[model samples]
Structure formats: C-alpha cells, structure tokens
Target: MLKINLQKKLQRFTLELDLEIKPAFTALFGPSGAGKTTSLNLLAGLTKPDSGKLSLKQKQFYSEKQKINIKPQQRNLGYIFQESRLFPHMTVKQNIEFGFQLLTPNSRKFSFDEIIETTGIVSLLERSPAALSGGEKQRVALARALLASPDYLLMDEPLASLDQPTRLSFLIFLKSIYQKFNLPILYVTHDIASVINFADEVLILKEGKIVGYDKPMRLLAQLQTRPLAAGEDITNIFKLEIIRQSKSRGITVVKSDKLEFVLPHLDLETGGELLLNIPASEIILGITEPNGLSASNILPGIIENIYHLQERVLVEVNAGEKFTVEIVEATVERLNLKKGTPVYLIIKASSFRRLS
Candidate 1:
C-alpha cells in the first residue's frame, strides 16, 4: 500500500496529492495540464514537497515535517520514463546489469538469466540501444528496472510513443508483470484506451488537486450519470458477446439483450465475450428510428438520464448496456429528450475500438 499527502506551491497552482493507493496498478489520469506528471515526480522523489508524507509498504520515503527526504536512488523505485533512457555507450547486457551490480549480492531478488528470459532480451544483449526498436528498448528498460528489485515501478507514459499494436504488445508484458510480481505500479498515461484496459484504480487530477479516484468500472458508471472532472465525460465501455461474423462484409455482429451492433472484424471467437469502447462524443441520437442509414449500429432504447453540459448534453440511453451519448443542447430540445423518452443511437463501425 502507498500513502501520500503532498503539497507544493507551484508557479501557477498548488500541487496537492492525498491518496491511499492499495491496488497493484493505479493509473494517474487527467487532462494535459492537470498536474499528473507532477504527482508522479513527487512520488519518485524527484521533487520535494512543501509538506506531507509519502510511504509505501511500511517504507517511509518522504516526510517534510519530520525532516526526512529520501534521495531518488535510495528510494529504490524503478522509474521508467517515456523514453528508454538506456546507455548509448554500453551494450544492452551492460545497460541491464548497471543497476543490478549496484545492489549488494544478498539484496538481488532476480538473477541476470531470469531477467533476460523474462524480458526476452537474450538475443539483444550484445546489441546497443541504437540497434534496438522502440518496443525492444522499452522491454530492455523494463528488465533493468526489475533487476533493482524496486518496491514499486514508476512508469511515466512508458507506452505513449509506441503505436497501437506496439502498445497492445507491451500491455501484455506489463499485465504479466503486474500479475507475476509483487511490486506496485503507478502508471501515468494520457491514453485512456490503455487505462481502461489495464488499470485497476484511476486517479483523476484537475489543476493540482485529486479530483477523483475509484475502481475503473465504478468511476465509469459515476461518469455516465454525471461529469467527472472539469466537465470531462468518460468513454463508454461495453462488454459485448459476438453472435455472428460475416467474411464478405469484414465485420462482426455483437448482441447485448435486444440491441445488436456491427463493428469492424476482430480476431475473436464468435461465441466469446469481447470488450470495446465507444467514446461518448461519437454517438449520434435520434428521436425516430430511420432506415437506409450508413451507420452500422442503430438501436432504440429509452433515455434513463440526461446531463446538460455547457453547450452539449450527455444523454444516458439504455440500449442494452448504459450507453452515454454526447450531443448538442439544441438536439435535446429538438428531440424532446426527457427522462424515459425513447431514442435511437447511430454509430459507425469505425467508432468502436477493440482494445482487447
């Protein structure tokens, strides 16, 4: 478990953090200028907090009032930034062994061979960072971080640079790490797609304050009924069961209760369950059901709730699962969308993301 209550006077706003993170993986998520990175820095001992305490697993890492501030190196936190930050002069093998060599022989939690095998970097040990691809470098960096046997891994956008496929690949490895190892992880990422797929607990920050924190599903449910932080609407996650497939049209049909939707073809079993996201902004609503529409998904369901935003209205429709749709305010009045009013939703095949 990690407990932190930090406060610092930044140039613009006072950066504050008061969180008790017990999950193996906690995601620090928010808008670009929400001070997410600053919180990570404070946790990693990179910045000194004006006042508060930081501790993880009974380890008192920082305390401004008690006059205790552990150095970054002494904190034993394996920090992985957006870049690999591997040594250019040394070979991959040397770069990986750099941290392991610093630790006393008795403190080593994993052997060199174990890390090499676990990270699948045996073939690239003799090569340099220049010779490695972005994904390979990240793998090597992960191995190096693990070699130190850190209590927690501080990953700041470790997969931000990688493409979707590469991100998916590393996500598997990171998920394995989260499951196999006892170490905790504080992952800072802007990619909400990745967050919903991997994160257990999500911390929402606005300006410099901790706006929200909860299990991903619960937080998403909360957002469905109301806005999260700074009028930000959460994306919609649906657990759909693939009922059939069409090779000619290159699409798969999924069903949830009475509603049926079609999406781009995915390599998933027809009878199996798949998780996908439809961003709230992508949905188009209508009061009357129409035919001959290009949209692959058009289903009718009653509007359970409506949240009026600045210029838009977030309509929560029960089209099988709770589907949150963001539409213009005028459309609300135009359609006479009151609670319990029936409505239809039109979404394109491209709007759905198969993150699984």
Candidate 2:
C-alpha cells in the first residue's frame, strides 16, 4: 500500500493532497497546471515538500516533523517521463543494461533478459534511439525503467507525445504489464479516456488540491461539476463480448450482461472482449416506445440517479453496470422520470464508439 499526505508550495501554486493507494493502478487526473506532475516529483524525491508525511507500506520516504528526507536515488522508483530520455549515442540494449549494472548484488530484482522480454524490445536491442520510431523509443524507455527493479513506477503523461494509433497500442501494453506484474503504478494524465480504461482509482486535482478521489466510474459521472476542456463530454464505458459478426454490413454484434450493441466493421474473433464508449448526450430516453422509430438499438433500464445541470439533466441508468444519458428538463418532466422508474433508452447504431 502507498500512503501520501503531503503539502508543498510552488511559485505559482500550492500542492495539498491526501490519498491512499493499494497495489493497483492509480491515476492522477486533472487539467494543465493542476499539480499532477508536482505530485509525481514529490513521490520520486525529485522535489521536496514543505511539510507532510509519505510512506510506502512500512517504509517512510519523507516526514517533515521527523526531519527525514530520502534522496531520489534512494527511493528505488522507476520513472518514465513524456519524453523517452534515452541516450542518443547508446544502442537500445546498452541503454537498458546501464541501469542493471548499477544495482547492488543483493538488491538486483529484475534481470536484463526478463525486462527485454516483458517489454517486447528484443528486436530493437541493436538499434540506437535515433533509429527507432516514436513507439519503439518509448518501448525501450519502458524496458530501461523496468530493468532498474524499482518497488513502484511513476508515469507522467508518457503517451502525451504519441500519435493516436501509437497511444492506443501503448495503453493496451501498459494494462498488460500492470496485470501481470501487480506493480504499484502512479499514472498522471489529463485524458479522461486513458483514465477510464486503465485506472482503478482516480484522484481529481484542481488548483493544487485534490478535489475528489474515488473509483473511476464514480468520479467520471461527476465530470460535469468539474472544470474540463471545451467539447469534452461525459462518456459511458461498457465491457462487451463479441457474440457474432454481420457479414453483409461487416459489423460486430457485441453484448454485455444486460445490453447489446453493434459496432462498425470489427476484426475481433468470437467471444473476444472489448470496451465501448457511449456518449451521454447521444442517448435518448422515452417512457413509452415510439411507433415507426428508426433507431436500431433500444435498452430497458431504470433511473438510478439524476443530476441537474444548467439546462440538461444527467440521468444515470442501472443497466448491466451503469450507463449515463443526458436529457433536457422538459423531457424529464414529460417522461416523469424518478428514481426506480423503468424507461427505454434509444441509441443509434452509429452512436457507439468502440475502444480497445
């Protein structure tokens, strides 16, 4: 377990947060200048706090009252920044082994061969950082960090620089490592999609303070109340398994426990699982079925919660897990939507956004 109750004052902003993370992936999510990077620096011992306590399990890394502060090198943390930070002249293999050579004999935890295999960087070992592509360079950087045999890993928007396709692949790779190694990860990112698919718990930061910390879905449902970028809206993510394929239209039939949806032209094998994102504003709610409707999908669900905004009401429906639907105030009264009231959710086939 990792516990932090720290406070630090910077030139422009002050950082204050109290969070306890278990042996799982925890995400620090917020807008720019929200102090997510500063928190990571404090954990890595790259920045010193004015006062507070920090501990990992039984080890105390910092304590202002006790007058104890550990150096960055003494913390044994694997750090991966937005840039690869690889040596320009060194080959990939050399860069990875450089850290392994500095580990003490008794402290050596991971082997070079294991790191290479785990990160799938064997083919790029002979290539220099300059010869590698963006994704390949980041893979080598990950291998180097893992080779250090750290107790925890700190990732500060490592995929922020990659293109869309590369970023998607890297996110999947990161999830695999998190599941296989069970390493405590402190991931800092501003992307909500990344947080939804990867993070177990989310810590929302605003102007140097932690505004909220809870499970990803719960925190995401409250996004309207928080400050977000323009054109950024709430997303409802669902875990689905492919049931069949429509050969004519080249679409995949996906089903969750309680709802079914069709996605455009997928190559997934039968029974393969995937994540789907449905935008809240794209959903339509109706108390009774409309005649001659053109929508392809309709789901029956009950209203679990309703959140009133400036002009819209975000209604959470209890489907398989939970899905959100945005509706207007006039519709809310016309439908007589109340907690525990059953209604039909109409969604167009094109409304579903397929994510890995």
Candidate 3:
C-alpha cells in the first residue's frame, strides 16, 4: 500500500494531496496546471514538499515533522516520462542495462534477461535510440524502468507521443506489467481515452486539489460537468464476452455481466472478449415496449438513477447489465420517469463502437 499527504504552493494554486493508494493501476488526471505532474514528482522524490508524510509499506519516503526524506535513487521508484530519455550514444540493450545497474544486489527481483524478453526488445537490442521509432524508444524506456527493480512505477503520459497503433500496443504491455509485478502504478495523462481504457482507478484533480477518486465509470460520472480537455465522453466502456458470431448477417451476440446483447459484428473472433464503447448521449430510453420500431436492438431494464444535466438527463439503467443513457428532460416528464421505473432502451446498431 502507498499513502501520501503533502502540501505545496505552485505558481497558479496551492497543491494539497491526501490519498491512500492500493496495489492497482491508477491514473492521475486533470487539465493543464492542475498539478498532476507535480504529484508524480513528489512520489518520485524529484521534488520536495513543504510539509507532509509519505510511506510505502515498511519504508518511509518523506516525513516533514521527523525531518526524514529519502533521496530519489533510494526510493526504489521506476519513473517513465513523456519523452523516451534514452542515451543517443547507447544501443537499446545498453540503455536497458543502465537501469539494471541502478538496482542494489538485494533488490533485484527480475534478471536482466527477463526484462529484455518481457518487453519484446530482443530484436531491437542492437539498434541505437536514433534508429528506433517513437514507439520503440518509449518501449525501451519502459524496459529500462522495469529493470530498476522499483517498488512503485510513476508514468507521466508515456504514450503521448505515439500513434494509435503504437499506443494500443504499449497499453497491452502495460496491462501485462500489472499482472506480472502487482506493483502499484501511478499513471499521469491528459488523454481521456488512455485513462478510461487502462486505469483501474482514476484520481481527478481540479484547481490543485483532488476533486474525486473512484473506478473509471464512477469518476467520469462525478466529473461529468467538467469536459475532458479534448471534450471526449469516457463513459460506458465495457469488456463484453463474445458469445456467438454470424458473419453472413453481420451481427454478433455478446454477454454482459447481467444482460445479453445483439450487436453489429466486427471482424472479431468468438470466445474472446472485446472492448465496447457506448456514449451516454446515443442511448435512447422508452417508457413502453415499442409497438413498431426500425431499431432491432431493444433492452428492457429498470431505472437505477437519474442525473440532471443542463437540458438533458442521464438515466442509469440496470438490466442485469448496467448502462447510462442520455435523454432530453422533456422525455423524462412525458414518461413520468423515476427510480425503479422499468424502461426500454433503443440502441441503433451503429451507435456503439468496438474499441478492441
């Protein structure tokens, strides 16, 4: 477990942090000048706080009252930044080994060879940083960090410079890292999609203070009014199991935890899982079963909660599977909707997209 309570005065606002983090992949998210990077610096011992306490299990990093502060190298933290930060003169193999050399003899959990194979950099070992692509350089950086045998990992927008394909590949690798090490990870990024797709818990910062922290969907719910820097709706991201697929009809059957759904099929294999994204604004709700409708996908569920927007309402439905639907306020009054009311949902096959 990791704990923090720190205070710092930035140029824009005063930074106050108090958080208890478990061993899970977490994202520190906020707009510009919200102090996400500063928090990471504090964790990595790259910056000192005016006053606070920090601890990781049996070890202590900072205790202002005690006048005890650990140095950066002594903190046993793996830091991956926005840039690759690889040595131009060194080959990929040398860059990674440089990190391994930082580890003390007693702290080496993984052998040097293990880090190389795990990160899939064996083929690039002989190549210099200049010869590698942007994505490849980042992978080398990540490999170096892992080899440090750190107790925790601090990543600051590590994928910001990569293209879509590279970013997805790196994300898959990130998930594997958690499963293999079970080390607490603090990921800082401004990309809403990256947080939604990767983070198990999200910490939302606003005006230099933590506004909210929870699982991705709930955190997004609490921060609904604050649009993502890019105005992306990071809602209703589901990992659904594919039950059956019909290539001829271009439809697939999938099962959520509670509800089974029929959706337009993509080129995905059956028996595997796929990421599905349904924007709240696209989900439609109806009071009664449709008498005649062009949309073939209709689900019956009960209203679990209702959130009022400026002119729209977000209706949360529990159909064994849960989902959020955005509808106009006038519809709410017409249907006399309230909690526990059974509502039918209409989802055009085109509305939901397959993420993976």
Candidate 4:
C-alpha cells in the first residue's frame, strides 16, 4: 500500500494532495501544469513537502515530526520521463547494464536477460541509441528502469514523444508489462484514452489540487462534476459483443443487451468482447421513431438521470448493463424527455470510438 499526505508550496501554485493507493496501477491525470509531475517528484523524494508524511507499506519515507527525508536515490523508484533519456554515446546494452552494475550480485531483483526479454529489446542491445526508432529507444529506456530493481515505477507521459502508431504499440507493450510485473505504477498522462485503457484508478488534479480520485469508469461517468477539457464532451464506454460480420460494408455488427451497432472493419473474432466509447454530444434522442434516417444505429432505453449544465443538458440513459448513452440538453427539451421515459437513441457508426 502507498499512502501520501503531503503539502508543498511552489512559487505560483500551492500543492496539497492526500491519497491512499492500494497495490495497483494508479494514474495521475490532468491538464498541463496541474502538478501531476510534482506529485510524482515528491513521491520519488526529488521534492520534499513542507509538512506532511509519506509512507509505503507502513514504512515512513518522510515525516515532518521525525524530520526523516530520504534522498531520491535511496527511495527505490524507477522513473521514466517523457523523453527516453538514454546515453547517446553508449550502446543499448551498456545503458541497461549501468543500473544492474550498481546492485550487488545477490541483491539484484531482476536479471539482465529477463529485462531484455520483457521489454522485447534483445535485438537492440548492440545498437547505439542513435540507431533505434523512437519506440525502440523508449523500450530500451523501460528495460533500463526495470533492471534497477525499484519497488515502484513512475512514468511521466512515456508515450508522449512518439508518433500515433508508435504510441499505440508502446501502450500495448506497457500494458503487457503492467500485467506481468505487478509493480506499483504511478503513471502520469493527460490523454483520456490512455486513462480509460491503462488506469486501475485515476487521480484528477486541477491547479495543484486533487479534484477527484476514483475508478476511471466512475470518474468518466461524472465528468461534468470534474475539471474536464473546455468544450470537450464526455465519452461513454460500452461493452460490445461481436454478433456477426458484414463483408459488403466492411464492418462488424456488435450487440449489447439493449442495442446493436455496426463498427468499421474490426478484427475481433465472433463472440469476443470489446469496449467502445461514444461521445455524449454526438448522441441524439427522440421520443418517437423516425423514417428514412441516415443514422445506422438506434437503441431503446430509459433515462436514468438528467443534469443541467451551463449550456447543455447531460442525460444518462441506461441501455442495459452493457451500455449507456449521454445525450445533450437541447435535444432533451426538444424531445420532452423525463426520468424513466423510454426513448429511442440514434448513433452513427462513425461516432463509435473503439477502445481496446
């Protein structure tokens, strides 16, 4: 278990965050300058709090009363920054071996060969950092961090510097590592997609203060209460089961308990389950069925709740246990919607964002 009750005042922002995280991967998510990095730095002992205590598994790393402040190097944290800070002059093998050399032979928690295989960088060992692709370099950097035998790993936007394809691949790789290692990870990212797929729990920060910390699905469902992106809409995740394939349209027909949707060319096998997101603003609600509609999908559900925003109304429609739809305000009144009102929801196939 990791517990933190820390307070620190910066020149412009005062940071106060109190959180207790279990032994699972927790993500720190927020906009830029929200102090996510600062929290991680404090945990790693790179930044000391003015007053408060930090502990892991009941061992006090920092306490104001005891005046116990551990140095950064002694904290046993493996930090991977946004950029892969590999020594350009050294080969990948040398870079990875550097940390292992610091540990006694008997005390090394991970073997060099295991680290290399875990990160899939065995072939790049002899090459210099300059010769590797962006993803390869980041993989080598991750391998180097794992070789350090740290108790916890901190990743600050590890895929931020990569291109779209590289980022996706790296994310898949990161997920595999998370499953295999069982190491406590404090991953920092501002990307909602990353948070949805990677985070076990999310910590929402706004201007150096914690606005909300909970499971990702819960936080995402109540996005209006949290500090979300300006003009950005909420995304509703749905559990979809592939029903059949439409070869002529090059799409896959997926079904939930209350709805059926056609998604573009998914590679999922029949009967496989997948997660998808539909933007709240993109959904349209209607009291009666319409004819000759261009929309490809429609579902019947009852309004579970309604929220009035400054400029929009957010409606939550329960579409069985597998799915929910969030529709905007103007349509709510235009359709004369009410709680428990059975309504037909329309969604375009293009609107569904597939989440792995």
lDDT of 4 by residue, 24-134 (tens): 778888888989888888998988899999988867889999999988877888999788899988999999998889888887888888889889899998999999988
lDDT of each: 0.81, 0.81, 0.81, 0.78
What does the lDDT read for residue 304 in candidate 1? 86
Please name the candidate that would achieve the greatest TM-score relative to the true structure: 2
Worst 10 residues of 1 by lDDT: 224-233
Positional deviation of residue 165's Cα in model 1 after best superposition, in angstroms: 1.6
Error of 2 at 183 (Å): 3.0
Candidate 1 local lDDT, 36-91, one digit each (tens): 77888898899888999999878899987788999999888998878889999999
The root-mean-square deviation over C-alpha atoms between each candidate and the true structure, in angstroms, is 6.3, 4.1, 4.1, 5.2
- Tens-place lDDT per residue, model 3, 160-240, is 887654565577678878888887788888776556657889988888898888877566656666544444553465667
**C-alpha TM-score for every candidate:** 0.67, 0.76, 0.75, 0.69
**Clashes per candidate, residues 3 or more apart or on different chains:** 0, 0, 1, 1
Check candidate 1 and list the clashing pairs.
none
**Which segments of model 2 are wrong by more than 4 Å?**
22-24, 97-123, 132-136, 163-176, 216-226, 236-243, 254-260, 266-276, 286-294, 302-313, 338-340, 354-356
Model 4: lowest-lDDT 10 consecutive positions = 320-329
From the highest TM-score down, the ranking of the candidates is: 2, 3, 4, 1
TM-score of 4: 0.69
lDDT of 2 by residue, 1-356 (tens): 88899999977888887888787888888888989889999999899998999998888999999998999888888999888799988999899988888888678776777778888898999998999888888889888988888889899898888765467557767877888877778888898655565688888888998888877766765765643345556667666899999778767888988767877768778999886777888998887766678777777888987876646677888765677787888888887889898888888878987666
- Cα error, residue 291 of model 2, in Å, equals 7.0
Candidate 1: deviation at residue 293, Å?
Answer: 20
Cα lDDT of model 4 overall?
A: 0.78
